[model samples]
Structure formats: C-alpha cells, structure tokens
Target: MTGGSGGIGGAVARRLAADGTAVVIHYSGGAARAEAVVESVTAAGGTAVALPGDIAEPTEMSELFDAAERRFGGIDVVVNTAGIMRLAPLAEMELDAFDRMHRVNVRGTFVVSQLAARRLPPGGALINFSTSVTRLQQPGYGGYAATKGAVEAMTLILARELRGRDVTVNTVAPGPTATPLFVEGKSEEQIAGIAAAAPLERLGTPEDIAEAVAFLAGPGGRWINGQVLFSNGGIA
Candidate 1:
C-alpha cells in the first residue's frame, strides 16, 4: 500500500500488476486517480483492486489489508510507498507536522510491516520506502530524513524477526525522483539543480523505482533479504 495516489505509488502498483502479481493498490484520497490506475492494470490483462485507507490510522489500514485478503487469498508482497514530506527547518517544524510524519512514516510502517511479516505466506516480501536525504543530509529536510532513517533502522531488524518464516523486509531509498510530491513548492530551476546533482545527470523516474520494487517482489530478489536498495540513478 502506498500513499498519495498520483506518482510513485501509481507507478509501483502498475509495474507490479504488469509482472502478473494481483496488486492491491491502496490510497488515502484521490479515489478517481486510484481507480484510473486499476483501470489501466485491468486493461493490460492484470488483476488489481483499489483499496483506500489512511496509513496513519490502524483501523483504516486494517480494512485495506482485509480487502487484500478477500481478493487475493494469500499475501505475497507488501510495498509501502505511502509517505508525506513537509519541509521546514528544525525550529520551524510544527508539532503537527512532526507528529504526522512519525505517525505515517514510522508508526504506520510498523503497523503495515508487523502485519505483513506475521501473516505473509512463504515467499512474501515487505518493501518500505526511504530517501537519499538520509545520506545527503540536505538542509531543511531534517524531519523528513529522520523518518526515513527510522525506516532504514527497522528494515534490517524486521528481517531477523521474520527469518524463520522466510519473509524478507527491506527498504528502498530513491534520490530526486520527478514525482509531483517533490515539485510542490520548488521552482523549475531549483528542480533542475537537484537533478544535476545526480551522477546520471537526470532525475529518477517512478518506473525506475518501480522496476527495483518489482525485482524485490519477484523471484530473483528472493535471496536479497534485509537490504536497502537505492534506486537513485547513482545519486549520493
């Protein structure tokens, strides 16, 4: 289940469905947009259902997962791309923003991952989203980086927790993706500058990140457990 139905989450859901996995595409708002994604999947001869929920709320998340069970019968992969990013310096960050960030990015991930790890049929994989800012230490991204850092810290430990079950928990950190989420308040020039920072001399794409996710969700990445795969086009 991913958040913000418009960008990376949409791409991930589509790519996974294309790989022949029955995808349960989760969203909070943007019902129309979510349905559009499902339509595309079905049109392409894949199975998918749009399940909506607030990742920050346990009851909502429960309903979302329940829908997955009702439709697919057995859970194989859980990709968590649901997240929010509100920028502010440490002093300017609001309590609400901090609370919201942790609630969704940290607590929400725990709720989703815990359930998946415990209930996944063998060969299941859990994929969580992180950010390269955790490594770049970009200014004004203090709180955002903290949430991703927490995700990274939990990814490996969860693998150990589920070792006996053969379930794998890992994290993906992308750098400078051209998702609508990143262009919210930036100027075109500012966006270009950030793109230039990557070694590939271009911004990342949702498909690029989704391709990595499909790998983990598929058989080839079965042996890759507890890893933080960075799909950032060589961006530091």
Candidate 2:
C-alpha cells in the first residue's frame, strides 16, 4: 500500500496495475485524489482499489492489508511508498517534526514490511522508498534523511533475514522530482534552478520513479536483493 494519493505512490500504482498487477492504492488523506488514481488505472483496463488507513497503526494496517487481499485474492508485491517530507535545518528542527517524518517514513515502512515478509508467498517482493538526500547530505534534509536512512538500513537487513523465503526487499532512492511536494513553496524560477542541478538538467517525473519500482517488483528482479537502487538521473 502507498500513502498520499497523487504523487510518486500514485504513479507506482498506475504503472504496476498497467503491467497486469492488481494494486491496492492506500491514501492517508484526499479521498478524491485516491479515487482518481484508481479510476486512471481502471480506465486503462487495470484493476485497482483505493483504501485509506494510518500506516503507523498495527490494527489499521491489518485491516488495510486484509481488505486488499479480499479484493485481489493475495498480495504478491508490497510497496511502502507511504511517507511525508518536511524542510528544516537540524538546529531549528523541532522534535515533533523529526517524529513526524520518522512516524511515516520509518515506522510506517517497518509495519508494512513486517507483514509482507511474514505473510507473503515465497516469491513475493517488497519495495520501500528512500531519498537521494541520504547520499548528498543536503543541509535542510537532516531530519528527513535520517528517517529514510533508517528505512535503507532496515531494508538491507530484512533482505538477509528473509533468506530462504524467496522474498526480495529493497529501497529506491530518488532525487529531486517535479512532484507536488517538490514544487510547493517554490517560485517558477526557483523550481527551474533546482531542476537544473541534476546532471540531466531536468526534474524527474513520477513515471521515472515508477518505472524503477516496476523493475524491482517484477519477475526479472527476483534475483536482486538487499540493494538500494538509485534512480536519480545521476544526481547523487
């Protein structure tokens, strides 16, 4: 399940569903946006259902996954793209800000991954979202990066722990992308300036990130495990 409907998670859902995988689109808020994602997939001849839940709560996650299984028989692939990002320097960062990022990015990832690793079929795959800031060490991203860093660490260990289960766990780290979150609070020129920072000289599209996710979840990626595949257009 993914969080916050119309960004990277939505793109991931659409791409996977298009590839013939029925997707369970999870949303923390914005029901209409979530429905739009589901509708997009359905219009393209793919099956998808949008459900809302708090990824940090065990009972809520349980119900979410149960509902998914009921709709699609079983979940063969789990994607924890549910997350929140905020901008603040370490010195000025409030405990609540740090906790908020960790709550969704770290705790949420662990909760979904734990369920997938234990209950999914042998060949199932679990993918999580990290960020390129973990590599570049951008100043304001200290708190956010710490949370994703936690996920990256957990993802690798989880892969080894799932040894014989035939489950592959990995994280995808993306650089600055032209998503709502990236564009928010930025002027057109400022957005252009940030986009130009990447070697490719352009901001990433959600589809770019989704394509990477599709590879990791598909049969072709079964042999790949415990690795963070960076798809940041060489930015990091």
Candidate 3:
C-alpha cells in the first residue's frame, strides 16, 4: 500500500489488516506515523510493516516491492494511495506546482503500477487512486483532475495489457472525503456546501473509501477489472 501513511491510506491499511491481510505500509516521509500504523495493526493481532520510499522513483519503488515480498513471502494486492493535490485554475497554476503534482500523482502511480505488473503473481489486484474531481469538473481542479485522468487511462490500458494473467487493475475515484487533506484549507461553510451536494448530505469518511478499496482487493471484486469505482455518494 503506497501512501499508507496518509489519512485514507492509513484507513485502508488498517482495514486490510483487520481482514487478515498482512500489509506493507509505504510512505514517502512520516516514518514515525507509518510505524505507528504498523504497531497498531500488530497490537490488534494483524501483521504489518512500514516501508519508506520515493513513489516517483523506479529504483526506490522496486526496492520497496522487493522488501515487501521478502517480508510477506508474496504480494497479492497493491493499493497505490499516495498522491499530492494542489488546486489552482489552469490559467493561474504555477508550472512548478503543476509539475510537482504530476511527479507524485502521475509519475509515481506509473512507476508503482509498472513494478506491480511485473512482480504481482496471478490472481493479484492493483488499485490506483483517482478523484471525483474529474467527474465534478470543478474550477481550480484542472491540474489535479488531469493527473487523475492520466491514472484512469493508464489503469484501463494496463488491465488489457495483463490479459489472461488473472491480475485485475482498477481505479478508485473518491469525492469530498473528510480527510485532513480535503478539510485542511476549507472553511466550515465551504465544507458544508460541498457536503450538501452529495445525496448522502455529508463528506465521505476515509473508511467509506477504504471499504471500496477493500472490496476491489478482495475476492468479491474479482470480476471487476479495467473500471473505475466511484465512491462519491452520488455527488457526481
């Protein structure tokens, strides 16, 4: 699990561990937090390990996968939840900020997915993270949405590329989740307004998104491939 140190990624890691799956928590930084997650899982009688690497670096990610396989024996599910979001209208966005977003969100995803394609055994699943912003088509989200759009496109093509391998690849696009990343800069009124747009009338919890990811990584989602599961609560 890449980005396993973040809010949604931590939730996903914990949930998977609760389901009796050993997890390798990958983080770009936040080593202490990642270790905390690993300790929590172990305290609950689940197996987990914290691994740190640069998601955008192929060599680093390759080492991560190697260490994970060495620790767990084999890898079956790879959930890439590591990403950065910098919201700015296309016209106003700085080139550096846009490049940074693509470096982590697009390039990072590609590097990990490529390694997974080569390493994951048959019957494995690869779940990439996207955002409902693509469907929302909101202003100031063009750059972020473009990165996710690239992820979606790569997911579909990779699924076909892995034909007959029984390895499933899919993307999960979430909307208005109440994670620190989403709630940090917004005011209460802004958050409430966004929440009200969803039919559920609330911002999504990290666990809600984690549930969708757990499904795709488990047997119940075996038949689901080359698709994007929108866990947006009908906002889109």
Ranking by TM-score: 3, 2, 1
Supply the global lDDT for candidate 3.
0.95
Better of 2 and 3 by TM-score: 3
In the order shown, the candidates' Cα RMSDs to the true structure are: 1.2, 1.0, 0.7
Candidate 1 lands at a TM-score of 0.96
C-alpha lDDT of all candidate models, in order:
0.86, 0.89, 0.95
lDDT (tens digit, per residue) of candidate 2 on 1-236: 67738699889998998899998888887799999999999999998888989888888998998998888888899988888888899999999989998899899998999888877898899999899999999889999999999999999999999988888999999988889888999999998887888889999999999999999999889888999999898888
Q: What's the residue-level lDDT of 163 in candidate 3?
A: 98
TM-score for every candidate vs. truth?
Answer: 0.96, 0.97, 0.99
* Stretches of model 3 off by over 4 angstroms after superposition: none
Least lDDT summed over 10 consecutive residues: which range in candidate 3? 177-186
In model 1, where do residues sit more than 4 Å from their true spots? none
Over the stretch 1-236, how does candidate 1's per-residue lDDT look in tens digits? 66637689889988988888888888877899889989988899988888888787778887778778988787889999988887899999998998899988999888888778777888889999999898899888999899999999998899988867878788999999998778888899999999998878999999999999999988999999998998888877
Off by over 4 Å in 2: none
lDDT of 3 at 39: 87
Angstrom error of the Cα, residue 59, model 1: value is 2.6
- Most lDDT-accurate candidate: 3
